[model samples]
Target: MSENDETNLPVDAFEPNRERVKIDAGAFVQQGNTVYRIAQVLDFESIIGIAVETGRSTPLAVAELRPVATDKEPAAAPDLTEIADPDWREAERRFAAIQPLLGRYMVGRIEVAGRAKEIGVDTATLYRWLQRYRATESVVALIPKKRGWRTGQGRIPTFAEGVIDEVIRDFYLTAQRPSAQKAVIEVLRRCQQHGIDAPSPSTIRARLKAIPERERLRGRGYKEKAKNKFLPAAGNFPNADYPLAVVQIDHTPADIILVDDIHRKPIGRPWITLAIDVYSRMVVGYYLSFDAPSETSVAMCVAQAILPKEEWLLLHKVEAQWPVWGIPRMIHVDNGSDFRSDNFKQSCLAYGINLEFRPVKQPRYGGHIERALGSLLKEIHDLPGTTFSSIKDKEGYDPEKHATMTKTEFEEWLVALICKVYHERRHSTIGMSPLRKWEIGIFGNGEVQGVGLPQRPVDRLTVLLDFLPSFRRTIQTFGVTIEGMTYYAEALRPWINAEDKEAPGKKREFVFRRDPRDISAVWFRDPSLNQYFKIPFANQSLPAMSVWEYDQAKEKLRREGAKALNDVQILQAVTELRGKVEEATERTKKARRQAQRRREHEKNISPAAPILPVRSTPPTPSIASLGLLDIDTEDFGDIA
Candidate 1:
């Protein structure tokens, strides 16, 4: 088939492909272990394909075919910065015109006609633009074709162009805004002094026209006006008409103290990272940990949000259903350093998620997540060992003495409260329960069609790996070393001491993904095979340990004035420290908490085994159990 025929295929043909896989007539797709070559795109729902090995025709649904990543596929996302300014602006304009239409599951013919009329375009043209935009989910896909001389490659002499640019920047774009004619005059005068032919006045005028309106206003000393025109309205909340359209995430310290597993004494309050869907006000994902808020907390929460929660719920032994799961279209967060990390930004970009930062000094931008967190804290205040909200509320109460729930037990109680209480209760703002609202959004009401469940990821591990922080290291004869840990696999043999392709004679740094919760193995992607291989620890006999524990061990050695610490010495120290913690678990709160944290980290890394036996209904603490109330009240019938 011709290349044009391949390029014109419907967007559905490319929906299930890898990040940079090209969707075309001859592209390869996989179904389980079978492979097929696309013969033709029959329709939006189905495709005609031929089995590669069997040489037989097969009709396949568009949803069944997954894009096969090969060496020919592009390795990175498109650099949108390469597009000319005019093209980028035009693409943005097109995107703004069609953004309202994108949230709908199905568009009626009348709706399309009305939008086309509003935009001054015909039906066919509008449909074509929509198709292009949907295929890539990027504004650059709508860029108009270049029909004239290439940008930045004009016929003007190099010196003349430089002079023009300098004059525009210094004179034309200053607070003392000069008239276009005067700017042109200045350019011509400069050219004359250099003894060069001056360009026409219209060329300079066109150049001035190309400057963006926002830049022009700021250049002319209208900073306040520019801000008013460009910034989003602070009072109104972000509009999210459908599920997964916008998700808000934030962090807060839990209001209740948790006890250690062995000693049953208070350790400290754990931090909570929460993600809520704006449309339904549902708590889609959360993370609880003793560590402070950081990139790992955000990553773990996002991973939980994207993957289904049935297994996680089961592992926690909570007999409740949590149906929320999907890749959100946009994630809204505050201007914290964790949210602004390069790793988080690149991961979201790779997964086609947009990251929006809260405006400086605008607290209302994140009000949704803040309010939800507040409600959860209120519920926590009712639990044993509660700190309440403030010192005034916590006065006369000793939370550490009353603390009774271990870390695992507290996790179970939190899950129960989220699924059974919070989700079931009606929300004042939404006028319905969160679970009900989520159901209506996903399954649809009578007025609109439901979008159904979001597409499940091809590989859950791959999705998690994408969101994880990465490190780069050069492979040596022994293997790759990271943070005093050495990992090795046969896959690194070919790349050992490989010279950098871009910089001759310099070593090339290969990328590796790791979970800080478990340092037993790291994931390495083989460039030649286009697949990931797990590189285990060089000393496989060493027990798995968290990065935090490793740091603690190293710090202990430093405190002892030990010099020249190596991997073996660090591991030995960790082993000895663990032994001390185990022995002191019965008496010291710190040791008990350390043991609990280690178990929690291990459970996160591998969740196949349940920590506690399955319970049909976990016991709830009562006022009488704390020696507060002994009298029982008779059951009262409903009063009029």
Candidate 2:
């Protein structure tokens, strides 16, 4: 027969033969286990012929043949080394119990029950589980399934779910947070409008409970609610992962009354600027001043915190070690005006310290520092003159009468307390002394690490000048005028009377940084050379006095109606005011507040240049140290 005619023959025509058949028509075919490549084509759809070992032609269906597997098939099994739980082991055990009965019809009910009882399960449950296991081939199927309505099934009509969800979102999660009953009423109202049957109150409650708390808050509640109720608690410093990672700064009025240096009489409370390391609960730095908390106080505290305190400890005759010093990676502070100063922000940025201002009205972010202040104040409460913490605590007690410690004495006592007691004593949060923790962080660990030190100049005067508050002044031909006082430096000679390119139509303005503690000599930076130059007052005869002193002196001049005042007149006013302050038997409340302010201002003046010689030309020193304002400068501007 022709090849085309043979190819059209019916599948049934082919039959096995003992003798050799030509079988010239070849195609891919499978007999029992092996696939044979037929040499010639036959009927392609139904059957193909192959030559076997018996030398007979055989016919097989085309459906039996399959192509060989390629590299796409995985060569090895997957990993299964993970530990299995008891439930999984039980499921595996149950599956093993049924292994023999697989693919076999049950012979008798009694036999099946006996087999299930062996595994502590009923026959009916076993069969159900076995059927599920067979379907999924997973041991997990042997575990009993959770009972009913897990996915909001049968509670509400399928068509009504969307309408009810929308109604609940609109009425339930508002700022007012209406009750579940109100949400149900709204849901029924919407369902009535949409021509759908409303779910029962119980059904509606179930559906509402079905929605996740997070999703409900996100969709319906506003950001404030979401943040307060749904968000996780923020991480604090004590639980910090590393040392110097975070620091917290805060201010509180000390709970004790301080006396003046000369009279030993009571003054108002001194404000304490406290900065504590979060990780170790160590008091990194603190500043005590009668002036209310200001940017200068913050700068003073932070600079002290970042520089080694060996010299300070020695000066105060403190025996214990106070090793804490480093520029913290981040500083957490409240939204006080002092913390928001441009000089504070810029200085922190220049040194790669992150200044984090806590949200307004949120005191939790600074809890560490707040608690430290509380602890320190508790220690102060044990001293001679403490107001205690609250009115209830201070009832019928005479803080003023008991007040014997002057400001200087109180400061000395504080230094001793911080070093000998607070640093050495065990802290509750860390369960160890802060000094011990500091040592462990630096040297106790096996790995190589060292304590961080300040990168900038460590000179007490230089550091003070670096962080002191600054002002804008134009260098006139005579000198640069600030706060009604004219200061001239040799460095100002070249740029006198020039206009600033950055600020149009304005005289050339240079930055003059000054310590509020002493306004006698202000600092001018030669921006080109990046060197600091100390500029002296043009008058040449004024003694070094705090901005507070200068203000009190100028106020006296204003009251005396002196039209043109010189250094001599200012000094006389200051001397007269001091005499009046000293003569008063009992200082008035206003007088006490002013004295406290004066004490704070004077305390901030660097001991480095306590007394500068009177000279008109600016004092020139080796490329080294230099460190705000005029008469009304203290009146109109913030001392910080």
Query: What C-alpha lDDT values do all the predictions have?
Result: 0.70, 0.60
| Leading candidate by lDDT | 1
For candidate 2, lDDT tens digit of each residue in 1-640?
1122334431111111101011123322334344454543333223345433334555554323322211221111110111123333334445555654543434366766776655444577657656655432334344323243444223345557677657766778766777778888888888899899987776566556545455577666466765776432654543254567788899999999877765667876888998888877788888778767888788788877765565566656667667665557678889889999877765564343557887677667777888888888999999888999989989999998899887768877898988888888998877899877776654435663533221212233444554678776778888887787778767789879777665688786666777777787787765454445678887777766777778888888988898887778887887777667656625564565565566556543332222221111111111111100011000001111
> lDDT of candidate 1 vs native?
0.70
Which parts of model 2 are misplaced by more than 4 Å? 1-239, 444-457, 501-506, 553-575, 585-640
Q: What are the runs in model 1 whose C-alpha is more than 4 Å off? A: 1-235, 446-452, 605-640
Please give the distance, in angstroms, between residue 522's alpha carbon in candidate 1 and its true position after superposition.
0.9
Model 1: which residue pairs collide?
Answer: none
What value does the lDDT take at residue 138 in candidate 1?
46
Q: Between which residue pairs do clashes occur in model 2? A: 25-40, 26-38, 26-39, 26-40, 26-41, 483-630, 514-628
TM-score of each: 0.68, 0.56
Tens digits of lDDT, candidate 1, 497-558? 99976689999877777778888888776555555677889887778998989899989999
How many clashes in each structure? 0, 7
Q: What is the lDDT of residue 419 in candidate 1?
A: 92
Top model by TM-score, which number? 1
